[model samples]
Target: MTDLQQNYAHVYNNSVGFGRYPCLILIDFAQAYFDPDCPLYAEVDSALASALRLRKTAQTANIPIVLTKMTYDVAGVTGGRFFEKAKPLEAFLPGRATGEFAKGLVPQPTEIVVEKQYPSAFFGTSLASTLICLGCDSVLLTGLTTSGCVRASCVDAMSHGFRTIVVADACGDRHDAPHQANLFDMKAKYADVVSEAAALEHLATLVTRG
Candidate 1:
């Protein structure tokens, strides 16, 4: 292992187990992040495919699913400082097609859809309370741009007292460097990083227990 990896291995690296009840959080799987023609596109087909598989499993297991989309007012008023810093967020301006959820991955009618103008879904939304109401003790996260929205959501999920699990293969970023680095950092600190297959297996166990 590299020196930095070894350092983290000796101290910060430790796994967090799933809690009794878990909810799935799909963060920002919007068209802007998936459309090749869009500047925000991240080439996340593998992650998207894994997330689809995880979504199917979650649905079958009756897990609570929360889908988050980033949206801003027509005037970009709600995004605040973040909007000013990242003008590219304008892609999600009200009524913009880029703000819509990707086709085939849209939330089901039964799923909860939380719209926010920030990176963390819980920042200005009802996500935490909703998860509590659903009796979710843990969050299984699958989403786009691991270095940004996914990382932000994972940290906030943990801060909200939920066991946070970042489905590694189901989370993507525009580049591998940030993706891998943030995954490592999150695994070492904020959340547990697991694969889509592992998440599915855990969901199966939950079903068997019930």
Candidate 2:
């Protein structure tokens, strides 16, 4: 193995295992990729498939599900530094299909959809209160752009007292290297880095035991 592979292996081996986690949060796996003309586009069919499976598992296990959409205002009230930089990309305009959730990853009627303006879902958002209200002490995080939004959410969730589980196969990025790097860092410091299969198994145990 290369040095990078060795580092990642060490990180994964040292990660904390899962216990009783109740909620699942899916980040942006939206259709914004269909337009090849856009800069933020990603062909994340595999990640979407993993997310779909996890969504079903969460529903069956009776865990609350939350989905996030990165949205921009008409008057541009929400634009921060990231948004400013992303204006050239412009793939996530509100009301466009690109801003909508991916084809097979739609939220169930009971699932909550949150519109976020920032990288971290918990930052300046109701995510903390929502999780608290649902009695969620653990969160299964699955979504797109593992290096950016996923990493930010995982760190914030850990800070908010939720045991965070980042579903490795269920998250992706436009570039694979950054994705792997962020996943490694998150596993080392903040969350349990797990495959979707393992996460489903743990969720099942929690459901059956509850």
- For model 2, residues 1-105, the per-residue Cα lDDT tens digits are 888667667445665566465688889777775457666777667888898888887788877899998888864568577777656325676666677777777
Write the residue-wise lDDT of candidate 1 on 134-189 in tens digits. Answer: 88999999898899999999999999999999999999999999999999999999
What is the Cα-based lDDT of residue 160 in candidate 1?
Answer: 97
Lowest summed-lDDT stretch of 10 residues in model 2?
10-19
Best by TM-score: 1
The C-alpha stretches of model 1 lying farther than 4 A from their native spots are: none
**TM-score of every candidate:** 0.97, 0.90
* Top lDDT model: 1
Q: Compared to the true structure, candidate 2 yields what TM-score?
A: 0.90
RMSD, every candidate, angstroms: 1.0, 2.2
